[model samples]
Target: MHVYADPFWLPKQGNTEEEYEDACCPRKVTERASCSFRCAVADGATETSFSGLWAGLLVQAFGSGRLTSKRRQETLRSLQGRWLSQVSAHPLPWFAEEKARCGAFSSLLGLELGEASICGGGRWWRACAVGDSCLVQMRGDAILSSFPIRDSRAFNNRPLLLSSNPGRNKEATTMWTSRGGTWESEDAFYLMTDALACWFLTEAEKGQQPWRRLRDPQTGDGTFAELIAELRRNGRMRNDDVTLLRVTVD
Candidate 1:
């Protein structure tokens, strides 16, 4: 199978790119032929300290297949330790230390695509999600499925999130969900952080072809940052770190 994967992202208004608290795996555009592929997007909670780093680790683990459904709690428990080690290697101020004790949190969504020759010679995909970060599978002019959060109205400031503290993760891990489906030649999958995802779902619910907007972004000056700025200014999208990973199979 031939796959094309592209990631677009922008930091929140007033926040430099360095402060963007979101992460994506395979953080580059690529087109290639392969039997399988793994991709993931994570949105770090800005309220927590070191959330960006925790988000990065989550995506890396997901993309590398280290995080899976089997023994998921154990896998995540190990990952939480890794997050702590990285964050606590140096001393922190009293305030930062207190925040660290509460721990970082992030939303995680991971997708895996591959050939399923044994299942009647077709392509297939599976995904898992921990929060509002969403995956929408498209075929032709319609969306085949949407994961984690389907309705735009379902979104809110509070969302279940993966935590960098093991003691606080049992609920999040238990709430994680998974889905699978067969892939078609012209299928496209869009993975997005909560802000862009809510907008996408809202537009679709209105009977508008939101996928078209994403597939062919009309960025001013041909830059995603400009497009995101426009969206935030017009109230079409929320003002937050935005990320989208579009993967097409042929």
Candidate 2:
């Protein structure tokens, strides 16, 4: 059995051609000899205050690499607590100051595919956010799951959750863990931030999964490159920084 992993990050248009305000990394863990894990952190802009810093810090904490549901919450709490301390010292006058030059939110997605299970967490959001990062599962021609962003009725882009304030009410970032299931050798995982995700899923529904298009047996040159060029040519996804990753399990 083999696994394939690919990650890409792009900035929004007109912003130095960098669509990502956060940093993402995946490392191997020894605790699980048969499985691999990946962690991603998407930092919000600096003008948003300490969001990016907070998101980055949380990813750093998971360096220990043994993630459970409890640990995920703990990691987020620690992130929040750290942010609160920093803010207490600096006292941000406005929320925008905490973000980077652009309004970005730390949307995180990770996967740990063990011999017996697959565990993951969706992106970050506050109480009022209307959307969320999607976690898509692919098995050949079928789409298994597309976890959409879930939020309370009041969510309206307020400062959601940050790693700096550990003691505050932890915003419930979504997590999925399956212990007993059958994942064929052809199963694949796709994680994407908002804009690119919407584009990909919409295309998938229209019988055009971007990855499938790129992997088409009959493509000439490179379909992925062509797709990128087409996107840039048509301004289809020039609004936000785009980050996309695909991993295949076998």
Candidate 3:
């Protein structure tokens, strides 16, 4: 199978792009070619301190295969220790320090995909997630699977998240969900942050093929910016850091 993946993102209106806190690994913009790989996206919680850094670490750990179910707690504790070390390097104001002591939080979605002989020689994908970031599997124009969060209404402001504080995040150790499936040539999968995910599902509920628009080659930086601007203006999509990672199997 021939595999291609790309990632696109835009920060909320009026915010500098650097202010965008979401992070991904095997990043959308990566140029490497590989038949088997791990990828992930993390959405940092705006209310938490150093959340972007926490999100980045989470994705990197998962993509590197160091954060599996058996190693979950150990890895998380290691991550927390590293984050604390990083925080200690910089001086923080009183309030920022207070928040830092409380730790950061983020939503995570991870995927592992490969051409496998086990599933009768087809391409297979496995996904794990905590929170609202979504993975959608499609064959042709129809959606074959939606994982972690399924319904459009499930895309609420509050989603269960992974935290940088291992002691405070019991749910991350136990509540993550995983799913696996096989795909044929021409199958497609999408991993999206909450806002764009909500829009995708809403459009699907209305019988619209949102993937066609998403998969278009013209959906680059400028086009995505325009589309997101219009969607936010029309109140169709929430104004947040939006991200989409598309993986196609051919």
The number of the candidate with the highest lDDT is 1
**If scored against the real structure, what TM-score would every candidate get?**
0.94, 0.63, 0.94
* Clash totals, every prediction: 0, 37, 0
Give the per-residue lDDT digits (tens) of candidate 3, residues 1-250: 5667788888888899888988887665654445677888889988888988999999999999877888987888899898889987988999999999888989999998887654356678889998899999989899999988789998888777888877667665476889998888778889999999999999999999999988888988899888899999999999999888887776
What does candidate 1's lDDT look like per residue over 1-250, in tens digits? 8889889888889999899999998899878788888999999998998999999999999988888787666778888989999889999999999999999999999999998663346788999999899999999888899998889999998887899987676664477899999998989999999999999999999998878877874632256776677778999998999999989998
lDDT of each: 0.89, 0.49, 0.86
Off by over 4 Å in 2: 17-19, 27-33, 41-47, 61-67, 81-105, 117-131, 149-182, 214-226
Q: Give the TM-score of candidate 2.
A: 0.63
Q: After superposition, how far is residue 141 of candidate 1 from its true place, in Å?
A: 1.3
Minimum summed lDDT over a 10-residue window in model 2 is located at 122-131
How many clashes in candidate 3? 0
| Clash pairs for candidate 1 | none
Tens digits of per-residue lDDT for model 2, 58-149: 44554345334567666655556565556566544564454322322354554445443433542211111112344566777777666443
